[model samples]
Target: MARKVYGISGMHCASCAAIIEKRLTAIEGVRHAEVNFATEKATVELDSRAPSLDSINDRLRPLGYLLLDETHDQGAAESETAHQATPKEREEAKELRKNRNTVRLALPSAILMVALMLYGMLFRPLPHTLYNPLAMILATIILFGPGRTFLRGVASFLRYGAATMDTLVGLGTATAYGYSAAITLFPPVRDFLGAGTHTYFDTTIIVIGFVLSGKYLESRSKTRTGETIEKLIGLQTKSALLVRDGKETLVDVSEVRRGSLLRVKPGAVIPVDGIIAAGDGTIDESAVSGEPVPVDKGPGDSVTGGTINRRGSFTFTAMQVGSKTMLSRIIAMVEEAQGSRAPIQNLADRVAAVFVPVVLVLALLDLLLWLTLGTRFMGFTEALPLALNSFIAILVIACPCALGLATPTAIIVGVGRGAENGILIRNAEALEKLAVADTVVFDKTGTVTTGRPAVTDIVALDTGTAASRILQLAASVERLSEHPLAGAIVEAAERDGTELLECSQFRSEEGLGVSALVEGREVRVRKPTAGESARPEAAALLEEGKTVAVLEREGRAIAILALADTIKENARSAVEALKRQGIQTVMITGDRAETAEHIAREAGIDTVISGVLPAGKAERIANLQQEGRTVAMVGDGINDAPALAVADAGIAMATGTDIAIAAAGVTILKGDVGKVPLAIGLSRATLRVVKRNLFWAFFYNILAIPLAGGAFYPIFGLLLHPALAGTAMAGSSLSVVASSLWLKRMKIG
Candidate 1:
């Protein structure tokens, strides 16, 4: 299946998103679809028979929504460069202007509503003058002007048989306004019933008036939710210093390509992902890596775009430019993750799909029941007014906007918060899974221990040669070998400033080490064969958890060199932290039992899965899952990709290979194992906030819907006024937004 993200237009609330989601899911070749109301984007999965965008839009356009390909730049919904006026800014301006214009047009209706409220409080005998031409004129301005969006919702229903939150507002206010207009325009209808000449022009004006005000406030608050994305975009540098033929020229960053040389000045942002060619500096990479410490970079080191050069200046060759840069990928990942829907959001979508229509039916049925039977208990005059009150209140309060905003708003904020902490949550499903994981499995190499091997011990046998002489011979041959252990011996020789002899005819074996003719003598550094046994000194070094390389002349062991992989400083602390959280930590390695056990004990890992090859790592994780444990895998190697994909929640270190990062759901940017626990804590906090938001949304509707429906009216002698119901409905959605915003202030680390 191929997945894609498209900008969607004409979404007003959760219901509008639900309608489009269901419609798109029904399309041929589309496997799944999720429309995020907060992000205003739809993530769709398509099969091999991929449907064209035009076909998808054709189905959606009739329902007043369209899908725009982000690449075409037509009707583009969001932009990455923050300093420019982009499509996102224009759309926001348009929405805010639309509301302000409506608020102005509804001013007279608002004033009239206040006058009616004061007069109705003082009088008992309702008159025909209450439904006069002046009131009808004001209500007409509201229904056509400020209520235009609501009318559009009604038109959508009439044209496509789709109902949304707007449908509720449109139907309720339109019913009240049409009835009141008929009573004022023609006296025959009022006299035909012989009931009363009462009109609900006041209900029509006040309900829409209050709703428009609440919508205006809600739009302002919603804009603040995208601040994190905007800040990330603002980090991009607009230009770079181009270096060519020993001359410096300032050019746009877009002009810099692969192999192009760009110079970074002190305090300037790195132009793109590149390798340092000259000079060195202290780089403040906190924005990209979430590590508080500034990193020192010299020649041959890699620098990332958007990181600031703090002290010195350097020039580098651009390896990754434009969208391929780390910062750009991060922004894109954050956006997609924010747009992706959580599994819990399905519950909201299902409810919103049927909520509007059910409320419409309930509103109509209650109105009919009140008009027919309520006249016996109270006179016709009181029954007609009470029925109108119940009708509008029921429709206005059960809008379901709160239900739609519950999950997406929190997910957006949560994903953004994770990005700020150097943790990239790929999607909402992983975020949820990580919050509940019970066991964390770590790949031993390059994860718990630094992958770089170093010389730890060296001892000479009874060969009458000094240990330093053995080191010189081994380093001389190992310098010609490409093995990592060979590099460690060479580096140790260099550090000791030992004299080296020129070697000839170097022959290196894969499983064994290398051999060379140095000064007409046969010198070899090789592993022990099946028949060969290590000396007592070598066996003691092996027991100390170090790999021993045997140095021999004439196929006999003369000296022993031992090397060990350095354990990360924070590995032990990271394990202890997980254990403190009641989580089990296991180390999986390809080393023999002795080395793996010793490393596990040193790193505080409770269990060790030793002697497993790279292919068996994923199986071990699956086995852990079969034992009823939620497994989270952490690794930083190409071999860890399969295990990362198979684990419940895969966290990849930034220092790892790209394939491993791609296979994982979460990424720690700085390659710090300590961040593993911090990421889990943040995920847990985010999930808790989602639960709280969901509860509040469900609770508000359960309590408010019945009150508006007059379930308690008969006994409590209480009825929810239409205006108050509208206010409460708006408050419900705003409260959810506020709850999501609270996540921004949490300090996860």
Candidate 2:
């Protein structure tokens, strides 16, 4: 079965929602139909074979409700829907619609309640003739007006041969209304002299009013708790600068096409995936990568859509546009995951299925037991009140408000906090697993180090001039090349503000370093000479195992520049923090053993697995698990995908490729390695909050239900009034929401 959700237009009120729900439910093989007037959407569950897509669309169109496009599973049909609104827009629209509906439902209900209260307070002892008629009219509107959702919910539950929180509520309110109507219409005959007058009209109105208020508050709070994705979507710009036939035009971001050349101005959001063809700039990719610092980019470098270009303008050919963009995919994944039911929700659903019938049977048994005790002490009239209270109390108290709030509240807070810190926890279970991760496997290149090569030390083999001067000449030539080592050499010279002599006739070797005519002489920077020195100072540096860029001019070695992929500034501190929390940190890389060992030692990593291929990393993770470690793999490359999937949990960098994010369970938005520890702390806190919420929900009802059902009447003769029972029920739901709100203030490490 495939689940589908679509925005349902033309639903003007709650009644219209009911009509659409009924129409959808009439379709054979439709398992569930939830039509929310506020969200203006219908979430339908159906067997794939029952109705074709065209058939479903045809049926909905005639009912004045347009079934908008179905949101396919993430990455399922990326190429087809280029102009579709992102998942974030859809979510926000749904929320807006829902809030509007809630207000519509709540405002009239509140006004009716105030009117009912005024009538009760002002005319307490009205003539019996006037009292019953006035109360009956007020009770009927409350029962069938604001209370209609409960009636529909009960009817749906009955049709499906299951029960829910709605079943209990519907039964309770219906019984109160029926009893009140019976007494009002058919005045009881007096047994001896005086007539007995008892009408439950006020009780019926009070229950419906209080319950509606609680439902409204709960709906608003849950909606607010789950707005993180909407906030993420708001980060994207609406349009892009497209260059066509030598003319620049501003186009909707969705209209930008692949192979189209886009001109990104300074401080503009890169609107499509493209390679940097010209110009130098720094991009603030924190939106995508969660890295605090902006990364420098120039000609030939690739840039993703949604990232901001911070420094200079560049023109690049778009490789991916619209839904194929990375931002769209992330938004889609988050939306689908949010709609997907968690394990706990599934359990609650199952329990609710059987819960209504059981309560109804218990209510029937209570009525029977009271009747069999004989009419000496109490007649049917007296026994009915007790029986009705039990039924109403059961429905009102048994709602899984706490159960519903438990996981979702925690997940919302956890994911929201994680995103704020640059960590994107895709699902609740990932957060739960991360809290208990014992071993963390890191990808060496991008995960630990900056992944960019840089010149560390310069050694002059034959000193005619200073080694710095040799580096200056080399930096000048290498500046024109796009190689990693070339950028490193140039960056080192630029950092020192060293004056680079002009160079002409620059030629780059594909795998080897560049050669150029510098200052009218041939200067070549390449791999080390084999026979120059077994114990050369450069050889010692190489043995310590750094990548050394050797510079030679006119066939005489001038200087050796030691280069290595330097560790990120936060990598060392993050490793230490993990260690303090008892998490073992390890590095897995395809680099040579000596270089890996050097990085591991400097970063304070406990284990080093070097020269491992992408598949080998997965095997290493499996091996670690066999040795009884709950491993978590942290990586940001396509090579890391296999290992990330194989580990107990995977933490990918937000700046990582789509394949890596798709494979990993967690993606850190902020490129800060420190978020790894923060994720763990958040998971722990969230789990704690969920458990506490569930416990209180269970404990409150376990104690309150018996008290309301007159369990304490035998001891202190104190039976809870039906009016107070409604208040307590509202209070219980309020308490659960309050507990969840406390999670918002929790401080994570």
How do the residues 1-749 of candidate 1 rate in per-residue lDDT, one tens digit apiece?
Answer: 99888877677778898899899999989999878888788889999886899988889887888886655232111212224554445566777888877877675677667777777678753455744676788889888888888888899899889998888898889988988888778889877656466677777888888788778777777777777778788788778899999999998676777999988889898878999999999999888888889989999999998889999988999998877889888988898888887887888888888888888898888888788888888867778878888898988988788888888888888889888878998999999899899999999888998888888887877569887888899999988999978999998899999988899999988887789999998899999654444567777778867888889998778888889987788999999888887899999999888888888988999999999999999999999999999999999899999999999999999899999999999999878898898888888888888889889888988888778867788899888988888889889889988988998997563
Best candidate (score: lDDT): 1
* Model 1 C-alpha lDDT versus the unseen true structure: 0.84
* Candidate 1 worst ten-residue window by lDDT: 73-82
* Cα displacement (Å) at residue 211, model 2: 1.3
TM-score of each: 0.86, 0.80
List, in order, the clash count of every candidate structure.
Answer: 0, 9
**What local lDDT does model 1 show for residue 14?**
82
lDDT of 2 by residue, 300-402 (tens): 9988777888998889988986677766666665554444343444443343334446656766665555445523456765765665676566666655555
Clashing pairs in 2: 38-97, 38-98, 39-98, 290-669, 290-670, 290-671, 291-671, 422-669, 422-670
Error of 1 at 200 (Å): 3.1
Q: List the candidate 1 regions with Cα displacement exceeding 4 Å.
A: 1-3, 25-32, 45-58, 72-89, 107-134, 191-199, 455-541, 548-562, 747-749
